[model samples]
Target: MTEKQFKKLKYYVIAITILFVVGFLLWEHLNGGILSHHLMHHSDYPSISNWWGLLILPFLAWLSTVRIEKRVTLQPDDAPVKAKILRVVLIGFFGMLVLSLVQSLSFSVGYESVAICLSLGLVVVGLFLPIYRAECIFGYVFGSIFFTGAIIPLIGILVIAGISWFSHVCIKPLVFRVIRAQPQ
Candidate 1:
């Protein structure tokens, strides 16, 4: 996509994110705050308002757009990569949203083991797809904010992102070097 098209897309994403958060807050208000209920009752997981999503999600949208824009500008010829990144971002957002909703709803119905597996599955996916840390982190936290709240998931994603980064940046190259040095 051209720079003009990318700019338009960025604005659209920001607008949609803001509108979604506003609509969610309104729905929560109308429902007497049912959406903001603490999904996990453990003492370690402090009760945080789903309203935090109002700020967090939009901020993530803006930040991701800016970061992607910088990357696209730096490699103007890499249109295929730009499109791939956009696809990954959209997939991550919707995929994680669906996963988080399923996990949260299942847990609410007492399927605690399913929820645990889903959460662990996310970590495993991150390990395997280490290059998409930013997209995954953004999507995971954005999807999680309503059901699981923001702070805890944000913390969890950060930890996962760190490990993914370490593996991607440090370990992967070392392994490649070792493999290349070995006899065929």
Candidate 2:
């Protein structure tokens, strides 16, 4: 990818990540700091919001993958994403299931922090799956889930924003430098 493209992708990732972090904070605060209380208490069937979140996972994966593809100049063969939509959906489903289980366990165990840690584990799974399996959607969706369980949503959002900034401003250029220094 050209330097220009890399810069553009970096900016886009930073902006989108910040937006997500802020949006999650607002949603949690407005809803009394619980992300899926409706699912936990009000409804047996998953709501439209739940399905909507799931549906968007593939699109988010596509966005992040496309950015990485261009930034790193990956050959089509270097990273193949087959059955892209289906894979993202299934992984997202698993993350959701884990999230639900953790939530339920939290109620029984009376420890919300433990549930949050498990939920963050789901996000880590989502993030790494994209790196190895060439599926990216899980990261965003699971990230939402991770932030959902945050004891202090504002702090979580700030941390996420900071990570985005650090990755884009510091890590991105360092990676390019490393790649340039390597012998072809």
Candidate 3:
């Protein structure tokens, strides 16, 4: 896909993300979780909604490229290559989900430190994974850390969000630049 097409596709994926979040909330509400409470605060375990989101996320990422490819299939493009990238991203998402689940379960069992450490570890792994595979790394790393901090009340959310924003704005690009500069 061309850059313009990719930009359009990003908007589509953003829309899908918004819808996924909304659907998650709806699922929570239907299951009797608080509508007023944030979705992350609604549970101690990885929500089914989250699993659903992760399951579809790869498909959406791949499909966006597929749509563009169908319209413009002439170039010596690497759209097909996106399949592997999205799959790796999906693995990262699944890893985060499992780790978050373990963290939540640990919190319920009064092993909060373990949960935080696991989250911190996941963040570190996420930091490296993006150097090799940038697709959805922010969501993987940030989402995992958020789960770790989610149990810490308001301060936790603020801290994780700050870290995520900082990494996204400052660190990720530098890593990408470094990776791009290295021998292929």
Candidate 4:
């Protein structure tokens, strides 16, 4: 996309994010405050309001869009790869949204195992695709914000990002050096 188009897209995303926050606030107000779970239980800590999303979501949106624009500008020729990444991000966003909805709405089903599996899967993906940190975090928090709230997912992503960075910056080079040192 051209710079002009990216600017327009950024505006649209900002507008939508604002609308979403307003809608969520209204919904929460209408049906009492939305309570956030701590460590997968509502009673483990004092009731935390979902109002945190109002600030966090917009920040994530801005950060992700800026990162995406920079990536597109730096490698304009990688349009196909960029498109694939976009598709994957969108899929992940919606998939997480659905999962969060289900886990929040249903009290009978055990989804802890599923969540653990998905988290592990994302860690593996992040090790290989460390360049999409902003996109991954944005998609994850945006998708799960309604049910999981903002802070928990933000903390989780920060930990994952750190591990991914360590693997990419430290371990990968060490492994490459070891491989090169071995006689064929």
Candidate 5:
């Protein structure tokens, strides 16, 4: 590559790295206060065994956004769309199932488990799926848009939900087909 191209690439990579680093620092600082209260504070650092738990949130965020710039290109036109879609769906479904159970146990009286599962399913699916803008759309929004007549009568809400589901579910089949077409 030319020197100019190399320089530009370096600049962009550096900028992105710095952004993630600062984000990590900010997240860590906030989580530090919460952890200090729940686990141990800077004052209690001497008394605590390991205060590193405070870093977990920032670590997660860092992990999530490591290559955020490339999330779109993470999967390509030539990629295995079906497998990718299936994986995302399965994972999203499981997460939704758990979220449903939690919601049920919290609000309802006797049908806690059932309610929880249903609630979790809806919420988790919304969360796992991302829209064109890469936003997570939860069940309340999902059901409202896609299953409008059935449950979600609000079009605005359903629109966002549909986008999220579409993002998650839409690409998989395409990827799968492309992969299958490749010569062995």
Candidate 6:
């Protein structure tokens, strides 16, 4: 969608993210996941969330335009393997979601640039907004924005590209290798 539309969309996504995170912390605080399985085993780091982070993968995959034509499952494996792939994808997605939020917030709040950076998300949002016709407006809301200068947007673009490339190079191939190989 347009830049104005993108800003509106980003705001909505940010709002939801705030609400979800706040509610989660509140819920966990009340429930005592202060020390839980997700806290211990699922975390990539000592300070992180595992629930939505783990499941945000498929949503993330859908969030991006991986291939223009060919579509393949992340890992070539059975149910269990696929499940594991999903988990890894979710963690990876968490990283992206978190970074996007940080970058979005930073650009909106702390940026001093005077340039606009267009994101691939804008294209996707525009396309989807017409196809899905408002049903998927929420997706566009978090698509991407041009809140900062060219440099910040470039930084975001590089960060996203770097993360995706690094994950593909290190994480995906390794996981797929294990999953794709035949058992002895």
Q: Top model by lDDT, which number?
A: 1
Candidate number that wins on TM-score, 3 or 4: 4
- Give a tens-digit lDDT track for model 2, residues 8-114: 76567556755665666577568765354243434775433332443354444455556554534543433335335435645644554455555545754688678
lDDT of 4 at 27: 87
Clashes per candidate (backbone, < 3 Å): 0, 2, 0, 0, 23, 2
lDDT over C-alpha atoms for residue 19 of model 2: 63
User: TM-scores, in order shown?
Assistant: 0.83, 0.31, 0.42, 0.79, 0.25, 0.30
lDDT of 3 by residue, 151-175 (tens): 2322343355456656777898999
Candidate 5 lDDT over residue span 1-184, tens digit each: 3336535654664455446445544665576531222121135433321133223223322433333324424556544663564356445434533443344334335654675466445445454545312112222222222111112212333554565567578766677889999999
Deviation in angstroms for 147 in model 1?
1.7
Clashing pairs in 6: 1-126, 9-141
What are the clashing pairs of model 2? 61-136, 61-137
Q: List, residue by residue over 1-184, the lDDT tens digit for candidate 1.
A: 7779889998998899899888878887898873544435765655667877878888878887887777667765776877877787678667866777787677778998998898788767766676354556677777766666666677767877777787778878999999999999
What RMSD does model 6 have?
A: 18.3
Model 3, poorest ten-residue lDDT window?
Answer: 145-154
**Could you arrange the candidates by TM-score from highest to lowest?**
1, 4, 3, 2, 6, 5
Q: If both were scored by lDDT, which would come out higher, candidate 2 or candidate 4? A: 4
Assess each prediction's global lDDT (C-alpha) against the native.
0.74, 0.48, 0.52, 0.72, 0.39, 0.39
What digit string (tens of lDDT, one per residue) describes model 4 on residues 5-112?
A: 889998898779878987987887789766666655657677556788889888888887887777667765778977876676566556555544554334326667
lDDT of 4: 0.72
Two-way TM-score contest, 1 vs 6, winner? 1
Model 4 TM-score, 2 decimals:
0.79
How many backbone clashes are present in model 2?
A: 2
TM-score of 2: 0.31
Question: What is the model-wide C-alpha lDDT for candidate 2?
Answer: 0.48
